[model samples]
Target: MPEITVVKVERVAGEQGQAGRVVHIERPEEWAACPECGVISTSVRQRRTTRPRDLPYGEEALHVRWHKRQFACKEALCSRKAFTESVAEIPPRARVTGRLCRAAARRVASGASVAAACREYRLGWPLTHRHFTALADAVLAEPEPVEVLGIDETRRGRARWRKNADGSWDKLERFETNFVDLSGTGGLLGQAAGRTGSAVEGWLDARGQAWKSAVQVVAIDPATCYRTAIRRALPHATIVVDHFHLIALANKAVTAVRQRVTRDQRGRRGRSVDPEWANRRRLLRARENLSQRAFTTMWNALIDHEPTGQILTAWIAKEDLRSLLACARQQQPRSVISHRLFRFFSWCAGSDIPELISLAETIEQWWPETLAFITTGITNARTEGTNRLIKDAARVAFGFRNLANQRRRVRLACTHQTINPAA
Candidate 1:
């Protein structure tokens, strides 16, 4: 066994009190190889000295006090040249210990900002940022491809930002649009238009066709852009208009019909339909606040209206919602339910509700994708959740001054760490 020896340890002097001193090393004859020759030369030659780094331990800064000597290559035609050998415990180019690098890597990977990480590690910000970028590049170079995407949009920067009298402007504020792949629960995908077809297409282009092909379905709102993007990129993928958004559309249609009925009454010669019908519309408008009995009374009042005008249109929306619910419950392929909705849209054209006509026209224009919902029930839940986390990250960082850094921070926040610092 080799006997252990104590080498000198010293305090490092620098700009800040945060730094520690460097230590000097003393090694036995067997501890080194010849720097100028290929052999492990034990014989001493006239030597030159150099200092290099060693592994760090807490506050102690470690360094190797190197005694460099030239060595002869023995072969006459070898054209032997002198070479210098580095110590085994440290890398030739690095000043910090491997342990310190690992620690910095872990901190940055865990979402610490580069400046904060540098302060914590007693290192320069540039070093921290470099290591952080290396880690991110590694992580993003390989990603698990996702299928079954959920598309949505968020607002980026509000309408109300302005610069002061000085050249500096107030920070840009943004809201998120989330797109998630339901199968993997991966973090948000598209940041472009958030849930629209354009956004989906952008994300698909980023993911590549192999990944897009794996996407069996895309759950989205009734946004035409989303439909167009899906057809363009993932041609075979199913499209599901989210049930929640569909329900909201139904409610909106009902509201429109109610307004039309009131307008029609005003145009008539002062003879109006029963006041109770309008009351029922109010009850429906305030549906979330009404009691069960009130709801029942509203429904009964609508039933008595016997299918005409505003009441009739509202009924159509109600029935349409019901049909959608039933179809969703049936758990058929999204394509099947989509076809049924197309037929329903056609049927709506014959009805008194003018809103239905517009809705139908829009749906018909995107009918191919609209009918895709029956096969795929995916939605943007994962994307939305990830977006919330991203916003929280931005908030904690006081909003990034640079967009590139902001994007990098988003990636760090969203990605799960697979590499271990302890390793």
Candidate 2:
């Protein structure tokens, strides 16, 4: 058994049929200073004992009996009062040792709920929560400067509703914008209430000039809200539209065109029997990933059986967009990508599909941002991963109705720090 400072340890009789140990600890110094005065005094005023919880001893609980003393101030003009002694192992007015408190906090930081950590450590909820908060505060105070930042929003829960004058409820988006440092520690920088320009801008603005100037690039979805905020908060930083988001938009367009064609031709929603409906997933899969036979079968069904070629045209446009994205990923020369983009736009214009046309216009609108992504090869992948962790922590806590607590826990989790004293 390792020795504990200022304490004498011994085996004690079990309580309630449980094994336990008792520690007798006392202040080692014979003299103390009066807190309010600059005088060092040796006059003993009073003595008392306190039993505070300590770290567990194996399967047994350990309790420390601290023999404390108070000394009176000897300064003649002192505001005359006596103060109790304090030790480094335990804070004043605390019922548990510092190590014990840290242990409880570590559990919470490692994904245990506050309630569960309290129960596991045989401590109260309030004390455990305080320790957890302190640990999070220490970690968040010195965030590393970000060079490449990623901004995105995660759905916190279902939309909130408020009753209107007509007794109807209006739904509002329930989201939290997460700012992540992709080029630094890969930890989340901050979270805001909504996915709005003001919410994001406010968080960035609060970071001050130094942090904003350190940012060289930002990866984000093609949302005007985020674009506005990034422009205002970090005007000099280049913006890269996330490749995954752009591909997802193209996929959505393809699905819409398929559904529209299905309805127009059959005069009803697609059923399981419809070949296009049944192989819908195959249609969305990347062309390179599809097997030769499967690809031929799908194309034959779309071309021969389908009366209108709208779905086929839409599929071709979707493939062309995917090829463009793939070309970007390959880091091909700018001229090569430019040639591909030209061909993509020409195809979209000739297809005459409204969905493809709209997609082309959106691509044109964000063309510079897309090129930035191709050149930099930076994406919001890290931000998406961090969001997953935040969501997992929330799920473990059974939903953080209190945003403050949620943010603290997320900080601790992302930094990979244990609340435990052993850590």
Candidate 3:
């Protein structure tokens, strides 16, 4: 290998009665330069033998025996002592050769587990993983500036409840916030622990003002903390709330209204026989997904079984909100958006149902962000897809207990190195 500068392949043969091929190697007898004094050294200090592991060859593992030395400084005037020689492939104190690490890490980048790499290389887990990380550290690129960035969170660990001194239990939720490049090929930029505003701001602050200023828009869910952090860190960036989240909120409002109506009317939860329970999933579905017969069946059943029309009101409000969102795809004409928004507001206002009213208030609260979504039509779909890949990486390893290693593996998995490695 080019990484080995001084070593020569002296012999490659199977020893008597040995099972595998043994490759004996040694440094050439030449004057070596003194590392500190810049003088040549010829005095011999000591000699030792090392067997650094290398990539497997053929069916059996090849054994490498390297005969190396420590040389005494030839310069008398230098503050000279002795030092061991090293090559690029075998750094000082490295037991596993560099090329072996690259081969194992390449396997990992191609979806092989670290344990599988370890078995193939016949190396320890720590050494194999360190090599994997070294290759990744060399390969991972810097976060490039992008016009649009998407932010989302995923669970970092299992949820737990810790009891306080006063006998109250506090939830301990672990999460990691993922920042994605929405306008570029950088699938995942970076990740930060926790889902708090401080966590978001801390990561942004490290990117420096120049990087933050280049970001013109950010797509995210309707998390107040995320918005607060973005405003503090990127004041110029237009925040576009994902339209999917708003639709989910509308569905959530429908469910809340149905549950409240059922409890109030029957003084208990709805059973499977109840029309409200039967139509629960249908109410959350988009209008296009249901057939006319199915819709008619649900309508007749709910109308006949329930005297109060609260569930119907919530469903109508949901459809109105959907129609309003659909205007975003109509090129967001001002007149069209105003008409749709007015119609949705009129429906919510006419019903005066607490659930529908609350949904309207939420729409009004995030109206500017909603307008940004309509105008730009940028969604957090990329970030959502990246989150799936991230979760898949977690599953491939079963799970990760250490956050740092997990992030390394995830970053490697999400934005795998495409460029060929130099030998």
Candidate 4:
């Protein structure tokens, strides 16, 4: 076969000089075969001209025009009369060259929105979207095996409405469960309809026992639904409670105590001028991150002014909980963590704050999982990062009503690979 090259270049004659190059390319002299009878033919029945988009030449756009030859099939019994020539660079019947399609797909998969990719690539939305969908489908068809799975839920939209018993409308919270493979730079395994146990179990069960057996750990927030599903689907896998969720719970308890104490002491909700209200964010911040003198001054003032010591106690309890997590992450012995945790539990029990007591009990119930988290050093931080990307994509797209397409886009984005090479 002869080497093909650009044989001619012409300036497009128009009112304005367009920023592009129109290159006439030569076709390789190769024998064509009849598809029906597999007979080789050398006859050129006709020649046709076609212009297809190609990869940009520098900053300028590229237009590829090829004089494609049609060959006549010589086999007597062959049903086909003629067929057009195709090459790896430019497939048959395609409006764009293979390289251009790949470039567009790469741009879209690399975090650029379809509209942005289309604009930058000088392609229409429909064409760009087609390439993106094809790339996503090819790349995300069979997910990688998951060893450490992370399950979490995110609010996709507002609550759905349903007719109530009295003809009134009731709102039901809508959620989607994301299954992430945390064994590597996390890729989304799948997304289910809702955050229910059944939804999670169904998705897991579909992966079969081989996948379930391969899973070593499953990390999740302290959600009972997720616990139930993981227990049923991956019974052997250790469930590790995410440390961030534990800290969030502690913050919630602190907030609850503050609200209750404020209502009782101030006779109303806290105002901007109030010291505690003004330093609300300071109260939630980790002690290590806060300036010692500033934190001490605020702490002393808030505790001294309030007649009830509940606020101070709540703050201490919150700090103690944070300290417990910090200690768990340290290279200390397990006995040290156990001792500190016991102290934290005792403090919570004596604190007399209902919120703290409740939090302590919840922690006690999930103590094994918490300990597993400390030992295994696994968390849902990756899954949370993936969730943020999913939300960002949705925000950029002005929100997605079609869950299937949204899932595809997310899988493509998270995996950063093509599922189908043929596409």
Query: Residues 1-423, candidate 3, lDDT per residue (tens digit)?
Result: 653444444334455643676677766656567777877778778888899988877765488888778889867788868777777788778888888888887777767788888888777888778878887888787788889999999996578689999999998757999999999888899999889899999999999889999999999999999999999999999999999999999999999999999899889998998899999989988888999988998888889987888888889889988888887787868888988899899899898798889899999999999989998889999999989988888887888878888898888877735846544
Question: For each candidate, what is the lDDT?
Answer: 0.60, 0.83, 0.85, 0.82
Best by TM-score: 4
TM-score of each model, paired residue for residue: 0.58, 0.84, 0.79, 0.87
User: How would the candidate models be sorted by lDDT, starting from the highest?
Assistant: 3, 2, 4, 1
What lDDT does model 1 reach? 0.60
Give lDDT tens digits, candidate 2, residues 267-299.
999998887887788888888999999899888
Q: Tens digits of per-residue lDDT for model 1 on 1-423?
A: 122234675666645556666545444444344443445444443465565433345654444465444444443444544434344444444566555655776687786766677777677777767777777677654346766777666554443467889877775445444556577735544355334556556767887778777877777777776678778998787777765565566666766766666557555332245653456445345344668887677667666753565555655555664465456458866676766675576667777467877656655565554445533445555666666767777776666666666666676677554766674
Specify the highest-lDDT model's number: 3
Taking the tens digit of each residue's C-alpha lDDT, what string does model 4 give over 61-161? Answer: 56778888899988778888888877777777977776677778778777778888788777888888887788777666766577899999988877779
Question: For model 1, what is the error of residue 225's alpha carbon versus the real structure, in angstroms, after optimal superposition?
Answer: 2.0
